[model samples]
Target: MSRVEARPIAEILAEVANAVPDEVIGVEFERARRRGAEVWVYQLKIIAKDGRLLKVEVDAATDRLLVAEED
Candidate 1:
């Protein structure tokens, strides 16, 4: 069993949904990842109306954006 307890995916999704930009047209859950005992990474697939797509990683514990590349 893992020593660190992670926040629920629904809760994380809610938080992430709030953090996402309003212009985003849609969102898809990519995957949930863990780095040893350090952090939980939540990857989201974001889509825009202009046909733009992005993959973002957010920290589950703190609800912080760990990575999001814009182009």
Candidate 2:
């Protein structure tokens, strides 16, 4: 089996979703190459009750969730 990266993408997304007060609509893993490493980028779409979409990107290796511009 391949060695898992710094952290699991599912765990990272779960943590971020739990931290958010809004409701999560969708979660997807994006394949991208970063810093010579094949990194998994998690795109989380949160649907607010007020009808707003919140998108965030979480790094699979670092589990760092970064809030992006609202959509």
Candidate 3:
């Protein structure tokens, strides 16, 4: 099924890149089942400047950050 997004995936990636200023290695689009509705989310895998790997998810509709994890 196709996912719905407020903006283009590139724009979402750009927003993430702007916040981290790191190398984005991988990106994935996810459809989350929420209250019987499918919500679009963008996952950004980044290589931090400090050499740590990070994962960030953003809400496609609101452009709000959902999660940010580093390893």
Candidate 4:
């Protein structure tokens, strides 16, 4: 297993949430875990300052991130 550089999880979460269509007023990294050997799973909740909320899943590994659909 290669050593993955530890990044500020908050930064990663922000990047993922920012990549979404509209800007989210607030974002949270609800949860995260290692998947097998090469994947890190993250569950995020994005909230628009106005109150719109969305949940998304992000998988990160080897300096890469994959965001999954909510539904």
Candidate with maximal TM-score: 3
Candidates sorted by TM-score, best first? 3, 2, 1, 4
Model 3 per-residue lDDT tens digits across residues 7-55:
7878887777677799999888888765577788878888988899998
- Return the TM-score for candidate 3, rounded to 2 decimals: 0.77
lDDT of candidate model 1 versus the reference: 0.63
Report the C-alpha lDDT of model 1 over 1-71, residue by residue, as the tens digit. Answer: 65544566678777766776535434444445455445556666777556677767777667678788654
Candidate RMSDs in Å, in order, are: 4.6, 3.1, 3.8, 4.7
Model 2: residues with Cα > 4 Å off, grouped in runs: 1-6, 33-38
What is the C-alpha lDDT profile of model 4 across 1-71, one tens digit per residue? 77654456666665765576544444344335455444455555666455666666555333255554432
Worst 10 contiguous positions by lDDT, candidate 3: 2-11
lDDT of 2 by residue, 1-71 (tens): 78656476567766876777778788788777767867778787888778889888777677776546588
Model 4 ranges off by over 4 Å: 21-38, 62-71
Off by over 4 Å in 1: 1-4, 21-37
Q: Rate the local accuracy (lDDT) of all candidates.
A: 0.63, 0.74, 0.80, 0.53
The alpha-carbon lDDT assigned to residue 42 of candidate 2 equals 79
- The whole-model C-alpha lDDT of candidate 4 against the native structure comes to 0.53
Whichever of 1 and 3 has more TM-score, that candidate is 3
Residue 65 of model 3 has an lDDT of 88
Using lDDT, rank the candidates from best to worst: 3, 2, 1, 4
Cα error, candidate 1, residue 68 (Å): 0.9
